[model samples]
Target: MKPIPVTQKLSVAAQLQPDDFQELSRLGFKTVINNRPDGEEASQPGTDAEAAAAKAAGLDYVFIPVTSSSMTDSDVRRFAEAIVASDGPVLAHCRSGARSFYMWVLAGDVDVQGFSDDKLVAVASNIGIAPDASRAWLATHRRTGKPDVKGFYDSRTGSIQYVVSDPTTKRCAIIDPVLDYDEKSATTKTEHADEILGYVTDEGLTVEWILDTHPHADHFSAARYLKEKTGAPTAIGAHVVDVQALWKDIYNWPDFPADGSQWDRLFNEGDTFKVGTIDARVMFSPGHTLASITYVIGEAAFVHDTLFVPDSGTARADFPGGSARVLWKSIQDILALPDQTRIFTGHDYQPGGRKALWESTVAVQKHSNPHIAGQTEESFVALREARDATLPMPKLILHALQVNINGGRLPEPESNGRRYLKIPLDALEGAAW
Candidate 1:
């Protein structure tokens, strides 16, 4: 897209992307103002993507959104303030440059010096923006907010645990935390949980919820342990019952309950909750497992095992109840979110021995994530199946599933106080050497 200059201090573009920031920086743009709110239009870029790009390009980025239906004075003021603070030219963008151009013209403090409203209207007209209609919209939009997120890596399972918090009140939710386990000694430890606990304490964060993306096959869940430590209620996808039922048969436990009674709360799709004042919701994203669900909290989504890092491709779907076919649908759903949404994944294999990385945007995944970037459902399934066929099962799958399916609780002792694990031999397929 071409940039239209309004003055020496500013330029307007219809919308900006992470890749666009570099050229804008080269063009001497010191600041970028996002006049688009997150999820305003499904699949449109969000502030996070633009901000990350701007940061990498050494440009200051600010989010000052204005909906087409309602543009408030506060929105204009915020835009004006960001423009005024820039040391070089500024670039402001939205779905169409109309919202941005309208904000610049309406933002009384902006330096549109010799151009009056009439001239601004003419300039907008040439750019195909209906200024009058946008003016009508300007007559009512407010700005939007963001979330606070942090990730912790467990070296053992290559899992990434996250703490998503409400900055205003410091209330937070922990997502997909790992339980430290040693298969050689059959020992369980709390180092992973302790790190999260320590961070929460140091940050003065109130643990509002303990979440498990699914019953992990790679590592034991720290949900129950974290809840015990923090007294926070635990939650998992409602379909965990299905997982329990499936695994119960495999383990040959006749009397085990298949109902999901272990978790404090069971989340179905579209279920909403709060961590402090920030709103969060659930999306059923299965395929890595039957119970895998994503926790979307205010522009950030914890998409566990759906899509891996761009370099690493996606998660395997050859496990029980797993389907690369279904995973394609799930990934499509996630990519349908605003492009700027911050996606914190569950694991990172540190491909090529690189450092662990979990943070990426929906935009990045849509274009670069090797697995889903351009492949169709049929192609993805073919490729995923081919790859999964060559990879061995996770080291702890046998040990972890029993504990994870039982709400991360060790089994009851038989007469003796010592707990024992039920490792079913010849029960699971692909029992790799």
Candidate 2:
């Protein structure tokens, strides 16, 4: 078997045959740890036969059966013991090699020289291991730093705009600002964006960046308007190019460039930037929209459209290019943040007509959010799909996308000096009647 090395002394592989044991020994593995239980599949060998082969090959063998359903602290302890007791290089095997790798991670104390815990967990997830255990480990070890946060509620759209600032430097970024729109009048105004500007001016805060979580469906982004007013750069997730391509087809804009040039910076997953002196990074949190992202600035996560207040539940994932399963995974990642990390959501429907509220913590969401808290992946998908199936398309979806995809700029004035919005008939199919 070809082994994928995890550390200097350890490597992992899929199920091994009796003939494979001699080749493993020849390759200088001093011990073999079997993480798969017997009879898992009809074609696989039993533990006794595998142990006999190892003995014949002059290599020590340790049996540590692990399954996704039955793994426990005791299993981790046994795996740790086997790892510590081994004299030299170890080759571990499981059905698909994920369980063996997972056990090694949970055992802890292994010096994966170049990997931080977050990076290590991401690596495990990429290799097909569920990240819950490691996510908990990450949350427990997260750094503690509170960045000052201010949320402005827009009663009209049920959206909340934010200004996350470094208290020491008084430097901040405006997130998901809205450009006021009156649907009946077919006009847009700067009232919402100006209010944010007023807050910045009064607080002596300098705007460093103007960011959008995604191309919004319900409201026009004020990224371009705010950039003109504050002179700060505008940014969005890099996958916006994908959204641009999709929408350009529906709008029939043959010459439109869909290369993500609309924004100043296109952020990729794990991309890091600074909000003043505070450390900030990007998490690609798509599902509500193809290009959605969450900005984890200091100890606060600007999780636009992924989650809402614990009382309000989560965002809807029925828009074009959205998926319930993908949204579930995105929410899990946000919940994986430190328990104390402040979660600022994009919209708050003010469910039950309660007063507008927009902030919650990771711990609160894990315990109180009905959309999460006890729901498995399968169950969550069922709930979300059923709920979304009944909901009508957002009233402003068509009106908002054209402007948002162009970085919040309204289309240029026509020959008569009047700007216009183009509405396509019969474009959105399967919308609620």
Candidate 3:
């Protein structure tokens, strides 16, 4: 079976491809669930073909097509039964990977008595999905008192990096990690990444993937550094090609490559992958940047640099290639998630004399975020444009973009055979404003 390209935190058999059953059998996924319905206006490889392939691959296959607007209790029950009866790890997939993920949450906690209340709410939050009526349904029906996993947050970076593991599975993946840097020295450090690495090593967790949400402009992406230390493959959103192009011209680097082939794997929206027991999917979320993406690990959405702490409001959209209108639309999609969904932001700049804080619920952002709360599209556009106009470029804008666009590697060696960075003469006269 060909390996499907999933989101960052999840792991899939390397040989598995979309609708590839033979490889799936070889890789030991005993069951396959096609969450995508047939006959949508969009062209898709039909479910029938996948079903036929699954059968040929000697795997139990089920088709539980779900529409975007409608997923019912009966659907949840059927999905749960399939999971319980499956002989081995299961593969569930759908368009944009969200529907399949929603189903996973539904099935994972279907037996709890308050499935519609507490358990469901907790699971959705754990996996970064917004809590809503659907989550309430799972919480109301939840039969288990103990959560399947636990989660934690870091206050200083305003990022919610997680350590997800199942005792039974012992499989784990770290998502959207913050690698602290020493700005004064122009050197890099790994205190944050080290903590994650220590946890994985101490707990005997196999680190499969070191992922980033995008080539961030505000904070450095430690994917390359972490990969070197952990021996994990590094990845980012595929649209990073667009970012590379944008910055390439801005820096006027004639020798730089344009196509976004920098990262090891360029994940597209709806892509799915695996870590250990967890399956993750990608949601193409732009606005923060041309390539910003959310990695949905199990039920959590690692929404990097999109929405900040709810009270702090949303991310800035004034960077090169960023559009306020597009950011508004992207945030709308995020807000549409279940209200209880956990939104792990990319970076946090603490305000109000508050301690650095990261992680917030969708409900909080929609209701209290000062910048975009109750803001109409037009109003948000106007506000964002005006605010952006008054803002100064990031202190490390030039340095950050050049390094990030190259997947975090510094410039190649010059004619002197030494890697060096250049500062354009007179590039910033009164431009400091």
Candidate 4:
């Protein structure tokens, strides 16, 4: 049997023979799990014979036979228990190795702490194996202490602002809050920020952080305003410096500080923080923007700009420093999260005039997103590039970036006591006419 290593401790193989048991023992496998049912094929070896061979070969053996239609939660738990009880490495086998691979995938749902979702997807992709029951498995499993998510849709900008809170502690964070701007009159207001503040006050929530997933292009960020009102620290991805550098030149501001010092905190990938008792982490997801990030708080992930509603496909990747291929990889990384993990999109177009939606599970995105379900990296890049070429830049990109890059602070007032935005003409060329 040719064994395929799924992880450092687990390997899978097509039905093992009696002779192969000794080889497996010599190869340091401490346990053998049979995922194949007996007597389905007359030529197949029975579990009893396999068990005896494994015993004689000085290896522990367990039979957890699973059929395509008969695999259940109990079977997955037993598989996880067997692995946990094993002394060393484990070698599981099934008719064609696919069943064992799937069993391992399902086992992860029961043993989330024992497995890394990214590692599982990486090995599964390497072996050309994918779980068919991922959605069903996630639907039945529940993770405790999931954060409460509330989405506030801004129809004018089509951006979704969020307040993710730990229900037990009543501590919350405002994510991607919008600073209302009316370009026609060149007026800015705190209507959206006040609405979020009202929710926090009504719910008796304490604001611990004001987080921005990225420097948004469509609307100005209310991060600075919220911080001043709440006295909470403001933060964004550390890569904001790169974006600041690129935009600083575009704006022709030589005195601009591009060191990402404007914000109270700059989070790197894998940086961990807390909102009350809830654990949160950062994942750098750059494609639609150079500094885009996803804040993974408990079961909810604030994936800003990289992914929109599945029906809306992904975001445009033709912005400065954006790459379609890079965006595809970032999308895959988000999809690799646990199927039950809640995916919170930053914006939704409400395609076909449906009500706005910002919440989806990783399972839904995996199975339903048109941009991801059937498209490979090469095809997705081609599609993204072709589509982006036909779309014009956001209306407020020039107006928003100046304020956003400076940590959502409006320009200093002149001696006349009035502030103004600096718009660079023809800076973004080749945009759709």
Kindly report which residue stretches of model 2 are placed more than 4 angstroms away from their true locations once superposed: 1-144
lDDT of 4 by residue, 1-433 (tens): 8789877678889888899999999899999999998998988889999999999999999999998667786787677767766879999989877777777765543223223334555655555555444433322432244667778899999999998887669999999999999999999999999999999999899999999998999999999999999999999999999999999999999999999999999999999999889899999999988999999998778899888767888999998999999999899899888765668889988899988877665765766688998999999999999999999999999999999999999999999999989999999989996
CA-only RMSD, every prediction: 12.3, 16.8, 17.7, 13.7
2 against 4, candidate with superior TM-score: 4
Q: Write the per-residue lDDT of candidate 3 for residues 327-430, one digit (tens) a residue.
A: 88888887876554556666666677765555555555665677767799999889878877777766666666777888767667889987665545544334
Candidate 1 or 4, higher lDDT? 4
Per-model lDDT: 0.81, 0.85, 0.65, 0.85
Per-residue lDDT over 1-433 for candidate 2, one digit per residue giving the tens place of the 0 to 100 score: 7787787788888899999999998998989999999989988988999999999999999998978667676776666656655778899889977778767755543423224456667766655556886666445433234456778889989998998887668899999999999999998899989999999999899999999999998899999999998899999999999999999998999898899998999999999999888899999998888999999998788999899987788888999899999999999999888655667889988778878877766756776789998899999999999999999998999999999999999999999999999888889997996
What is candidate 3's TM-score against the reference? 0.62
lDDT of 1 by residue, 90-192 (tens): 8888887877877775553135322433565677776577877544443322112245677889888899998888767989999888889899998989998
Give the distance in Å from residue 21's predicted Cα in candidate 3 to where it truly belongs.
62
